[model samples]
Target: MATAPLKRWVKPEIYPLFLAVGTAVGLCGFAMARNLAANPDVRINKEDRAAGVLENYDEGKRYHDHAVRRYVSDAKPEIMPGINKYFSSSK
Candidate 1:
């Protein structure tokens, strides 16, 4: 038995029309969302922020400062004591 040709669901020329319609719809939706968000009546505030909890920026900054001081500013000799000639003050 011979295999039958597959039926075409959408025409090639209609693809551009679909794309244009989809883009216009997406742009309309985006504009609507922006306007709605800017509206004071529906505008969200820090009380209703997107994230459940805000991170503590100061805590992170303090940790970074401490790490820098401990690891970089007060760095200790890593090599064995006998081979620490380069870091030795007497050298």
Candidate 2:
């Protein structure tokens, strides 16, 4: 018995129409999201603000320095041998 050709969910001729529609929808959604982000009235929560500040401004330098010092002094030298090298200095 010969095998029959598989049917497509969307016809080849109409697939471009679907592609165009999907592209337009995606672009519209992206524009809307961008506008929302740009809006000044958007209120970010305190935790998010704190995290963002810490991440963007390197406010955790003190804690990180303390942690690195503590790790170097207190942690076993054999474990994580070269890991300290990465956090040894900050540019």
TM-score of each predicted structure versus truth? 0.35, 0.35
Model 2 earns a TM-score of 0.35
Q: What global local distance difference test value does model 2 have?
A: 0.61
Q: After superposition, how far is residue 86 of candidate 1 from its true place, in Å?
A: 60
Q: lDDT of all predictions, in order shown? A: 0.63, 0.61
Candidate 1, residues 1-91: lDDT per residue as tens digits? 2333223547687789999999999999976885566433343676656555545677455645664376766656565755675567573
Among these predictions, the greatest lDDT belongs to: 1
RMSD, candidate 1, Å: 17.1
Candidate 2, residue 43: lDDT: 31
